[model samples]
Target: MEIVMSGIAKAFGTNQVLRDVSITLKEGEVHALMGENGAGKSTLMNILTGIHKADAGTITIDGVERTFPNPREAELNGVAFIHQELNIWPNLTLLENLYLMRPKRNKFGMLDKKAMLAEAENTCRELGIELPLTTEAGLCSVGHQQMTEILRILMLDAKVVIMDEPTAALTERETATLFKMMRKMKARGVAIVYISHRMEEVFSECDKITVMRDGHTIITKPTSEISVDEVVRHMVGRSIDEFYPARTTTPGEVVMSVDNLKPEGFDNDISFSLRKGEILGVAGLMGAGRTEIMRAIFGVDKHNGGTVTVNGSVLNCKKPEDAIKAGIAFITENRKSEGLILDFSIGSNITLPNLDDICPSHVLDSGKLNSFADELSKKLGVKTQSIHEPASSLSGGNQQKVVIAKWVGKKPSIIIMDEPTRGIDIGAKRDIYDLMNELTNDGVSIIMVSSELPEVLGMSDRVMVIHEGRVAGILDRSDATPESIMTLATGGQ
Candidate 1:
């Protein structure tokens, strides 16, 4: 089956999200869509999957023009879209969720439960996914839930499968498995449209690449015809030098120290110390307590036992406000729910945590708020028409910038970033890496939690590998390799 989208245009009120965009997917070819945050990639995928209607366009599937009013219509036509966010029912079992809408029936009109369960088991086995069929979806890790979604798509017998950031929440081994499955799908003549910010994955798995920018298609070419830098240049419309800036200052005296920290779900005891001007990386497999440790340190989650010392002074933190007042900033891993207020303007969102500084005489001060947001946005290079625009209107990368700006506005001495570059394109990723360098140079201590091996190894001066709620080992930059880190992270030590 082949898919051709021609002259597509879509608009919402005054915002034109997509403009005359054209894309083609040949049978058995994996097409990669590349773009920066807010480049209309999601909108285009929505239109293709029947979530939204195109103002002007023709969707030709196998040489037949079709207008799908909803996802069911598209599903009936063998089109399946696996969104970045999982849509599975968490309370249900994996087998139940897979056969939710489609049930096997006998001649007497009774549901065939045995047949559905057998089919689900077969599908999981075929994909090389090890999941308990009876286990609740909510009880599994993020990576396992993602695998369940992929299995659902396979069971549907989809001719055209669209995957959006499929590996964003996966570990290295799980990602490898997915790539193998993608190759298998390609061999079966399934047209796959893969959307990802990871250039390495795009080059490794995709056969054709399509770049989109400012609501329009830039170019569609073979993956082998271009380099990563050239693809980035096309996506961002400019050349970037030095993605991660080199550190300037040597690590000074220890600024913060934690001893015997234990939080719920994350067991055992953890201890670490961060020196002034040092960027410490925390690496682990999914559900290995990296996020739990950070959340506990920031006072977002309650700690059963721990002692935190800042600058040789014991700090009492009972809540997030206490942590904030103690000069600590936390950037959450889930950007959508934990980081930004979508309905608020960029200025409001940026100054939300530090509203007191922007107000005077017990009244809101619009001038000070706008000035603060303007200064931070300019420094962070956030691409936006105006600060008055809603945060939801910005792209994923810009929204992340707003989150970082909000915390940086308070001038926190210690910053903790969890998966800072997740789901963002390479161009924006470079900017974030540069920002980390600038902060460390200014004597701001940073604690970063990441799942990507290259990013963990490339950016951090020290890496801490955690396995099953414990620090397996700590490695210096000189000794941190994928093989070495994975060995510790998987309990090989």
Candidate 2:
């Protein structure tokens, strides 16, 4: 089936989100939609999946005009959307979540449990996903949860699958598995619309590329005819040569040291030293305890046993506040939930951590707060009309900047970032890389957790691969090849 969208226009009062956007997806081909954070990619996908209705447009599937008032209607018509944020019920078992809508009933009008389990198990195996059927969705790892979502779409027998940031939380091996599944879907004549910020994935996996900019369609070209630079140029209206800035200063004395760190679900005797002016990368599979380790180090999670020494002085950290007061900042992986207070204004969010600095003598100093927010916003190149606007109104990239600014105001000696560049666009990613370089030059030690191999390899002075709650291996920059890291991450050595 061919999916054709023409003259799509949508708006939220005075904010026009999409205008004159057009795209087409042919059966058996993967079409990638690339754009900046505020670009109309998500809006357009929502309109296609019936999450949002287009104010003006014509959607023709298989040469027949159709109307979808809701997602159920679209699903019934063979369209399914795998959102970036998985919508699985955490409390439900994998089989239950997968077969939630479609249930086989016995002759007595009772639910057919055995058949459902068998079908779910078979589907998962065929997709090369090894998820326990009886395990609760919440108990499964992030990678498994993602696989469950993909299985749900497959179970629906959807003809057109729209995947939004499908590989955002996936590790290298899991990403390879997803690519294989995508190829299988294409072989089965399913039209796939892939939305992603990673340019390499777009060029490597997509048959055609559609670039969107500021609520409008820029162009749609065959993948063979375009390069990553060209696509990024169209998305941001500028060319960025060095995504990761060159390191300015060499690493000095060790600033932070962790020895024999042991947290729940991660029992490995982890020992590592972070020196000033160095960025250390933590790479692992989704369940490999990378985030848990960071959380424990930053006192967001309790450590069963460990010793943390900063500047040769042992520090007691039992809570996030303790870590903050001890000159450590943590940027969470899920920025929306853990990092920012979305309802607050940009200034409020940025100044939340350092309220005392902005408001001395128990008096609220709005002027100082605004000045700090403005300075950080300008420094980070956060695109916004006003500092008083709600943080929720900004794009994902800008929201991330607000999180960074909030912590940067504290001027922590050590910073831990988990998936810092997860959902942002290319332009914002470059900005973040530049910021990391600047911070390192200022002698701040950084501990970064990322699932993207290229980013882990490019930004880190040394890479640590974790697997199954253990430090699988540690490699210096010169030895941190993709093959080498994967070998350790997958337990090959």
Candidate 3:
């Protein structure tokens, strides 16, 4: 299938999301769409699949004009979209989830289980996919759930498939499997629109690349023609000399220490220490108990045994309030659900955490709240019309900034950031790194838990690798190479 989108323009109130964007997708090719958050890449795709009508544009499939009324219509016409967040019914079996949308019925008007099973088995055999079809979806691994989505698309016989950040949550092995499936689809004359910020994957798996900036298409070229630097420059509209700032300050005395923390469901005890003005990076494979340790330390989860000492004082791990009252803040990995209330205004979200600062003497001060919100928003570079605007209105990168700002307002001495740069654009990542450096420089210690190896290596003063539920090893900044970290993460000595 060949698809062409030209002169696409969309506006939400006064915000012009897409301005004169154009792109072409050829048959049997993998085309990559690269951009920062709020760059209008998702908007363009939404318009193509009929999620939203473009204010002015034209889309043609196989040289014929078309505008699908809805995603279901697009899918019926051989177009499918698999979003980053897999839409799987956890309570149902894998087979049930796959055939839920289009179930076959027999002459008696009952469900045709035999037909569905045979068809699914045939497709799985052809694609080299193996899974327990009768098992519940929630019991399967993330990779399996993702493959189910892809298989569902293939079952539709989709000529064109659009993937948005397909491997964002997959492990290395799972990512390889996903790329292999893409190759199989390409051989069958299917077109793929791949959207991701991971440059390495795009360069390795995609045939063509298109970079978008500020609601406009900057350039579209073969993957071989453009360098990573050029693509980043085009996406950000400037050259970034330093994506991760160098750490210059020396850490002072230890501020927090964990002594043999045995969180529930852990097979081994965990221990770590954070010093003043230092960044302690936690790295591990998925299901390696990296997040479990953080949640237990922050009182979000129960610990069977351990003692947390903050500035030589024992902390009561009874609730999250204890940690917060002791001048510690946690930024969870699932920011949308735990970090911010989407319907609340940015100002209200900020005020939720620091009510004491905003409302002292048992009285609420509206003026003080506004000033506090304004101060943090401007300081953190939150791109919003006003602090009163709903948090849902901001982009992912900006919402992350708001989450950080919400904690920064509390003036905490110790901050724990889990997946700080996940799902954000590169430019915003640079901003967050700079902010972390500034925070550490000002004597605020940081515990950064990240899945991205480059991020942990680039921003850490000390790198701690966890294998299974145990602390594998800790290395100084100079000793934390990719090989060294991965070796420890995989249980190598």
Candidate 4:
């Protein structure tokens, strides 16, 4: 299949998202779509899949000009879009979630569970994917949910597949499996539109690259002809000399400590300590209980046996509010569902947690609320025209900024950041890194749980490896290498 989108343009009211953008995807090619948040990459894809109409553009698929009425039609026509967000019914079993929209029926008009199971098993076997079909999707880990979505696209047998940050939640092994499947699909003459913010994956896997910036297509060329530095320059219009900002401040005395912490579903007790003005990065595989430990610390998940101490005071936190009052904040991994409300305005989301501080006199102070939100938004470098715009209006990176802004307003002594830069662009990631440096300089402590090993090594003053719900080993920044971290993460001695 060959898809050529030329002169594409789209606008939402006064905001023009995509203007004069073009790209070409050939059969059996893995074409990378690289851009910063709000750079119109998703908007262009939406237009192609018919979720949004292009005001001025020509879409030619397989040498014939055509337009899809909706995403369903596009999928039926062999163009599948695996969105960045997981589209799973938490209450439904994996098998039911897989065949939710279209189910096979028996001759008597009954659901054919046998046939569905047989087909699903065959596909999973082919892809070397192992998942419980009977388990509710909510009970499964985020990596499993991500694999399910990818499996759905593979089962579709689409001629053109658009994958947006497909490996964001996947482990190293799962990512290898996904890349293997992509290779197989390519051999079968399927064209894949791969979208990710990970430079290493793009340069290693993609055949061609298309860079977009500020609603315009900057350049499109073969991957072999371009370097990561050049691609970043095109995407952000400047070369980033430093990827992760260096941490200059030395860690102070311990500000928080967890001893003998044992959350539900964990057999092994966990323990750790965070120093003032320090970044304690938690690193491990997808299901290594990194996020679980963070949740337990923040009081979102109760620990059956543990002690959490802050400022030399032993504390028992029963809920999130208790932790919040104890000067702790948590930035969850799933930003869309947990971090910010899509329907709410950006300003409202930022000021929601600090309402008491803004309206101290027991009165609604609109001016104070607006000013507080605006100040934080600007401080975090959120690229939005107005704080009054709905959070859904901003791109993924900007929404993450709002999430950080929301938590930072609380002036918490300890902050837990989970997957702080999962799907953001290079420029936005640098912004967050710089922000972390600033926060730590101000004597604030951070516990960052991340799946990205490079991020863990780059920003952490101390890297704590977790394995099977237990602390494996904590290494100093100078001593922490990729091999050392992985060894400890995989239950090494």
Most accurate candidate by lDDT = 4
Clashing pairs for model 4 are none
> Residue 271 deviation, candidate 1, in Å?
1.2
Model 3: per-residue Cα lDDT at residue 94: 89
Candidate 4, residue 19: lDDT: 90
Local distance difference test values of all predictions, in order: 0.88, 0.88, 0.90, 0.92
- lDDT, candidate 3, 1-493, per-residue tens: 8999999999999999999999999889999999999999989998989899999989999999999999999999888899766789989988999999999889999999889888898888877667678889987756578778877887888889999887766656557777888998899999999999888899999999999999999999999999999999999999877668898879999999999899988978888899999999999887688888999999999999989999999998778999999999999876786899999999999888888877878588889999999999999999999999999988888999999999999999999998888778899999999999999999999999888888899999999999999999999999999999999999998
**Number of backbone-clashing residue pairs for each candidate, in the order shown:** 0, 0, 0, 0
- The predictions' CA RMSDs to the true structure, in order, are 2.5, 1.9, 2.7, 1.1
Who is ahead in lDDT, 1 or 3?
A: 3
- Mark the 10 consecutive residues where model 3 has the least summed lDDT: 168-177
Q: For residues 1-493, could you state the per-residue lDDT of candidate 2 as single tens digits?
A: 8999999999988889999999999999999999999898988989987889899989998899886889888898899999887888989998888888888888999989898988887876777778878999888767788888888887888899999898887766678889998998999999999999987888899999999999999989999999888888899998978667776668889989988988866657788889888899999778888988888888878888889998888878888888888899999988886899999999899988898877878688788888998998888888998989999999888999999998998999999999999978888898899899999989888999999888899899989899888888889998999999888888878
- What TM-score fits each model? 0.92, 0.95, 0.92, 0.98
Number of clashes found in candidate 2: 0
For candidate 1, write residues 77-176 as lDDT tens digits: 8899998878889899887778787878878899887888888877767777687778898877677888888878878878999999999988887888
Which runs in model 1 stand beyond 4 Å of their true positions? 88-100, 103-122, 131-140
Please identify model 2 stretches exceeding 4 Å from their true place: none
Question: Candidate 3, residue 372: CA error in Å?
Answer: 0.8
